[model samples]
Target: MSADTQHSSQFALLRQRRFAPFFWTQFLGAGNDNLFKFAFTVLVTYQLQVSWLPGEMAGLVIGALFILPFLLFSATSGQLADKHDKATLIRGLKLLEVAVMVLAAWGFHAQQVPLLLACIFLMGLQSAVFGPVKYAYLPQHLNERELTGGNGMVEMGTFVAILLGNVAGGLLIAIPEVGARWVAWSCIGLALLGWLASLKVPASPSTDPALVINWNPVSETWRNLKLASESKSVFRSILGISWMWFVGAVFLSQFPAFAKDVLHGDEQVASLLLVVFSVGIATGSLLCETLSRRHVEIGLVPVGAIGMSVFAVDLYFASRGLGGGAAYTLAGFVERAAHWRVMIDLALLAFSAGIYSVPMYALIQLRSPASHRARIIAANNILNALFMIASAVLGGALLQLGLTIPQVFLAVGLLNVVVGFYIFLLVPEYLLRFVALIASRCIYRFKVRGDEHIPVQGAAILVANHVSFVDAILLMAASPRPIVFIMDHRIFRIPVLGWLFKLAKAIPIASQKDDPATYERAFAEAERVLRDGDLLCIFPEGAITRDGTLQEFKGGIMKILEQQPVPVVPVALQNLWGSFFSRIEQGTAMVRPFRRGLFSRVGLVAGAAVAPENVSPAGLRERVEQLLAA
Candidate 1:
């Protein structure tokens, strides 16, 4: 591809007119939400110091207020998103933000507690209504390949906004010259800015304009949840996502208190903690785009979960030595013993959170059915609200039961490990992708070539030279599709490794001369897999190389193609001959124990597919040899 025609960067979308406006519009909106909320929190906790609700319980109440609208209105909002043009919805939402800010400004001027709480709930409502419109608009604008990058940018923006807004709210309210007025007016102006940005966002057509609106929150929410639950994987992913919210809510809601009671730090120090955490999240989120090669890689989900759990556990240890009533400023907090460890723990925890979240959102976008996608997102929002609320209730319960903040952190971290293990066990593909991601990125140095020759969609026969036992896993790591490999039945009995292949659903092919029934049954299974529109990979060599030389292609390729008539793609693996799986010593390949040093260079080359009618045994061998040579 020419430089002019190729995409420059995943972030290059931000420079384009199609995506830039909406990005800024939403960015400003998220910033405004946090700014207003925190400014109010500062007013209540620091200045007013209300006695009616103790400081410890105040965060729970405010957080519950903020997310309440999500539980109540997510379903109706989803219907609106589907029933109206997204750009129009964005414009309307921005206008609503303006009106809400006016109310917020009025409440701030009067120092009315009821009105401020109402404003917080209004902000939550704004966020809830925008949820479906926020995500569903992406697929409408970008191609499938762009979705991961686009979501990454969105996550980066949200976390950055959260950081900036919290910083602004935390700082501005403390300044006597600025106080609530400056905060309120700044929010008003930001809302107007968001509205202007929304005006420039191009129209994104609704997915289901003809659908009737469901006003009943109870039944509609249930219906949306049911829609999301129809797909088992997506549903489990939704649960995973909600659990993320739960973990997040507990951690974030405690920072203000944690900074005071545990770290002996002031409000500025708490704000700095949030700032550090948000920065970590933004960094990890952007890194996910690069790490996954801009795909919805479920593997990163487990990796992220692992990091989050480990760091969260460490956070408890880091914060254990807080001597209460010391009164440390931000700089003093840093000067204290082991305090730097706390910041590192918070940063890594949020960083892993960013890595964990982006891929899951992309997975949802790719997995969801288009017609009901908005409702699915709405269901996700509802569940998110529920989980967050539960976090508050459950966390308050834990605190009441005499658990310290560190103990709570320890418990949550351990719980994360359990949940992550459970999810990965239920879906091994995530674990496989994690393995593949590690292999490609860190283990063997792989250089893939001629990947463009492989068709992006539809059934095809992938005939590769099986130079190493690791060939199938390596190819799967490289290819976007899930490939079902045809392996020798004996190899499938190799204890642990064999069990993994069986779990991967690799077809066990036997040599017809030795076992006719098994051979015939394998062919029948291959046909069934292809007919189901899945990718099928076969080693036409019928065995790995005894020596590092190209073997003559067996006739199985022709036989399968005759039965299935799928396009045949020829692939070659080079420079893997001396690997432990290869027959480097020639005798007893499995027992010989031979391998290239770590980080050995390896290459995989693919050739254009040959039509089923055009492919012959000799021609296919020539193609494979040509690829290997190239």
Candidate 2:
């Protein structure tokens, strides 16, 4: 694509009505969050006297104000999101922000630091409730192809907001004569504007209107948590998101002290560090779309985690050069901007965080059950709250125990290495490409063609000849984007293979007799996927070929085609007649040995896409068969 065409395509996404409002709402929310928190932190850290409350105590108080809401209100917020129109819910939340900002203004005017803390906590509560609606609503609004781009945009916006907020908060604090009060009022105005913007958001139907509302925070939170935990992928995603927050919270919380004690810089320099970090996050988020080539791209998570660790460790060394002395004023810090290493560390830390988070969010949205998505999101919020709190406490405790802020950075960075290794080891499916490449090198070699026929950037339906059970895995390896395979529900439940499929987010379909509802739901999900611009691969023969011959095509493929006019790519898999995962012995307990050595040809042929107008199920089947024959 030419530069202008590419620019138009990118800009086209922003023009979308379904996406724009939610994008703005989230952007404004993230921006306001940082604005208030950074402002509050600056107040307590620089403006308030130590005699009123120790600096450490003030920081702890600020931390508590931010996290306490998740513990108190996340469950209720999730339940509410499921029981109402999400657009209305979001509007209501934005209005709540207006009220909270009023209190903030009062706190600023009266110089009541404690009251401002209360308002900060209230904002957190609002955000905790907003979290479920924010995530759950995406699948409803965006097509699958749009999801990645949409997510990338939202992440990019959020980081930009954080950067803006951090800059504004610091600048406002330095203003004279009711400057802090004016900042609070400006925040309130922004909140109102956000509310007005949210009102323009189209209605989002409730996924589960009949979901029982639970008022008991403890029990309800635990129930939602348990429900999400039941799905291993969802549970793991929660852990991954939590780990991100833990890592981020540690870095963000210590930045001020690191600037003051280690870099001997003033509040402006501290805020500059935040700006650099946010810039990194924005860069990384935008990079995710390009890196994944527009898929969920779980593979990037490990890569991101590694970058975070390396940069954070380097930051420790970078901080060691600062001589112990009294803190410099804002002007003094600017003169010391020659330290390029500090800039590098800040940028890398932020960039890696963006890379780590964006994919995980996409995975959760793609994998979670549509009906219970809000609850799952609520569960994620709970875990994030818990993790961030733990991060603050642990980092603070370590600092108290004589670990310098720089050392803490190094420690977290090193620990991230261990954590990343463990998660990948635990879930190798996320690292399937690496394994597939190694397998290709040692065992059966494979060839992929007509890949250009597959939509480079939109949803498609792939019809392939299923030669063996490993066909989906092979297809996934060959295709540029992730494929949501339509599999026999039975195979979807296979011990080891089942785990892998679920991780890959395959949609399982059952025979009518076995479970009619599940079968219908699978088709519905397939339709949803196509509508969202995702690729759904199905074996028209309905099951693996028993005698290495194509079975009669099923009507399910027709049903999918009828629902969406997206391109249908025909694929042919060959030469896997005898492999360990293939069924060489029908109805027998025996299996073939693992194939080894290169030059064992495995051909994956992709034919030109069959237009929806010119093709029926039979036509698609015939085309695929011909491709396979060639």
Candidate 3:
């Protein structure tokens, strides 16, 4: 089949039943999270008269209950996911959700606030355990090409769920007849529905069946966290994801107060702020697939962070003009729509969050080893939980120390700038891209075709002919998204290029004898990248051609294909041979005088995609040769 047709066919598979059920299950999980929390917040703020615990303290308690599970159970969940059938594990978790809901019902009926909070904590436990399985299950069901779109849909669904759930929770609790009980019952129903959906998921074979389960939460958590930190890109991605949670936790925790004191809105209006935020996240999540053009583009992370800071600072000013104690009904909110600045802040915040999170999720997935992919994800959850908890404490402390909610928003927003700058500085790959992008426009003219062969957004494997040492950099520069290159371990150690590749999060592999473990790790990392919907680029020939001609494809690509049949976009780098970095005249140094005006024409020819069925080492080599010849 033609590459275009092949690419389209692979994407269609993602919409099928085997994948959709699991997607919905995760979607509902996120939705239920917000739904229950919103309901609890309403209960604390309006129904319960707690003179002992201040409002901010109550908010902190709710936040803690939700995050505590990640700290306690995420490590164990990762082991469970690696050792068991993911489908069965997910179904079991769903059943546990039912019991948790029953406990929630008891809390609502008894008017026992602490019991309700305990139930929330239990719910967080269930979610924390489910986190690893949610991520690990994807590579089992999806092809590489579909990973990005699949992840994008899940993220989008999650935010949509958050929006709907928050809205429902608020509306349900405000009802006069059965406020708290009604919300509890609704949560229960949703949990059951999530279980039903999970039942439809196909069985997923364990990658590590003999893995010993670690029972001790603290030590196991530390071990998993260390595993995540071992890889540079994986480590940075975790930090990026954790920072997002930190920023989000701060903003979300303060929204109720912001709406009440600043916007002068009641419970309904406060909920609307959440709704706007969730809507923005949903919008951004959906747009990720398009904006990234289906590749893992970390550049978008910076873009998202910038928006987050800008809008957050603007929100403080926006609140200044909102006046005080001006409550509005649902209908009144529409009538007095002059408070649209709040809407802008909410939308931008969510949108930036979407941009920031999609790539980080993709990056972690791409950079982690498959054998321990879920564990790494669990580690990420652990850190996310920790950061979120800290955000709550920090935000609360600031407020108690006499900072207004709007001022807290400004502080967090400003802090985001500092944090973002620090991360970029530490990992200059993002900065290099900005430099490369500017350089590409000025140095050499280039064009990309058949970019559609790449997924509109999600995981894909880019197979390019390696004509020069800078093949990966050139591809990274040409493509709109970030490309995770699989490199010779030796190339990864090159002085300047090595550091650049490290910063770019390139995966380095070696032959079995040199390092069998590293070789296995390379493929495992590639699998994770595919699972996260990030781009994985490998020189199928395994090394750059000495004579600027495509070589035979290597079986490593085949091994990756076996694990995940992601769409493979064949890229040919044309006319880059005579450049300064190119291997001109058997690699004799061309370093000094020729470097200044040594600009050369470069062309990135993106041929149609090749499906897994159509790809073999021989066939892929021949196909790449043809593209290069063109």
Candidate 4:
């Protein structure tokens, strides 16, 4: 990240050369694609009223046409992205967009539905190729700290562009006399602009320049899926993201019917719903950077999932008695209080969608191997396409059973809960992050300083002062990566805390004198964790403070470092001594609720890493003491 982007708004990316051009190019491409598709759909459904394509099926046909290429060509596209410079691929894709728009312009002017449909497939193909390059290009440029914010901006921009494109298309096609001509010109103009913007995108070098192109879509797509599945976290995160798209597709595809039948609203009212949804997504996307504190935090995923389900289910109840016979205009809809609940529900559901998707994208980018990252993203695209198709099919089937639109909404919302839990259970990291986030953000107003001293990768030992029973949880929140805590065996016996730690795979140790076998087993597990290049944290004070004071530093950390020889980082937990989870009330922890009240300010400060040879029990304690004092 540049100095401007360190803690500043993500918009700072717009002022820089590396990101701005790419952003605009992507923005224009998405806008142009939607503009062209929406305008054509409107023409077929309202203006032409062709016998071959009925008005009711126009949107579905157009959507299917647009999504077809993703299923067929994503594998090849991912390979091309890895085999060639992304900027070059992007520029070529933009030029292809220009050509496709030129054809679309001709189709629009001639009222040639077949030609326009072909252009839709072509546009989808262009977008499909661009997808991998788009995500793969990010990790190559932005650091880990910038990934969440950068992905957030891209997601926000995409949704905003979609909204603007739909609005522009609707308005342009509604023009009198030369409406088709206007749509044609606008599409062509946007394509040209996209190509112009692509010209300024900086060169992004290929990650796998020598890779052979795989022409077989089926086989290559299978290969890509296999590649992604090799990394359990990345593969599961992909599924989580696809499931979100599934939920979103169900909600979005139902909106027109939802507004017309359920809300008894006019076209403008439907547009209002769209505007609200888009704005919500944009707001949620931008919120990730601040919520994650500039890291690729997966914790927000569960929060988003819960909010999505809650608001969606609420929307069903809110709209149950809404539609009878009164068709309300946009202004009338806003004036009604009951309708406002519906609007708020839609906005929050969309917002939760935004929050749900961005971190998963960031996590996928951060974890995927650079050499094959684009391919992994390609696998994700394939899954997304399938999940969306499933959503549409399933939603349609439910409605065909005579279910009301609001009932369909209720079903999907309820289904989301099951899906969210299933994914979280499969990928325990997500659930763990949720717990850590709740502890850090809700239970306490937690903050961290000098967190950059913690390595983003490889083996390292985090030695911290154990001030409370939940210190490990707070420590997990402090760092972007997972930490395998070597905790006292006694803490593992606590009711809910023990279960949580077991889920986190926390290694529990007893005093050597009390249980020598458990002590040795804990050391063996800790060593294995470090040897696997994972972070290992130890409360070197051996126990939580009984008197709100630091205990004598233990030599256990030095014993581990002697074998691993990894850098040892000193960490201090401040203001946690008197908290509810700490042993401050009569030297017993968790005895009284709200002992420090809620959201008490507490902090974890990490100091510079000491070389293995330079680490000692006293020296590390001094560093922790200094950090606590600071």
lDDT of 4 at 57: 54
Q: Clashes in model 1: which pairs?
A: none
Per-residue CA lDDT of model 3 for 1-630, tens digit only, reads 344523553235456776778877887877787888888887777667787756656667798778998988999999999899899999999999889888888887787888888888988999998988988877667544455666677787888888888889888888886888888788888888998999889889898999999899889998998888888768887888899999988877776666666777778987888889988987887776665545566667777888999999998887776645558766676566567877888799889999888867876776577889999999999999999999988988898899988889899999999999998887676666654544454565545556656664678888888776677776876675567889998887678778888877789999888899999999999999998888899987777667766677878888998998888888788876666556657663336435536344677778788877888778777777777677
- Looking at candidate 4, the ten consecutive residues that score lowest on lDDT are 1-10
What clash count goes with each model?
0, 3, 13, 0
Q: Point to the candidate with the largest lDDT.
A: 4
Error of 2 at 132 (Å): 0.6
Model 1 agreement with the true structure over 221-284: per-residue lDDT tens digits: 9999999988766888888899999999898888887887888788899899999999999998
The lDDT of model 4 is: 0.88
RMSD for each of the candidates: 2.3, 8.6, 8.5, 1.7
Q: How high is the lDDT of residue 553 in model 2?
A: 78
For residues 1-630, write the lDDT of model 2, one tens digit per residue.
Answer: 343423233336667677788888888888888888878787777777747666654555577569878877888888998888999899989999989998888888888877887898889988988999988888787655456666778888988998898878877876777668878887887788788789878899988888889899999999989988876666886888889888888887766667777887778888888889989998998888766655566667776887899998999888886776877776776567555688888898889988888888888887777888888889898899988888878887897898978888899989998887787766665566444444443566767766657775578888988777778877876665567888988886687778778777788888989899998999899999988777889988887766777777787877777778777888988777565655656632225454433457887889998777776878887988898888
Best of the candidates, TM-score = 4
Of 2 and 3, the candidate ahead on TM-score is: 3
In model 1, state the lDDT of residue 282.
Answer: 91
Q: Is candidate 3 or candidate 4 better by lDDT?
A: 4
Please identify model 4 stretches exceeding 4 Å from their true place.
1-5, 324-328
C-alpha TM-score for every candidate: 0.94, 0.75, 0.76, 0.96
Please rank every candidate by TM-score, starting with the best.
4, 1, 3, 2
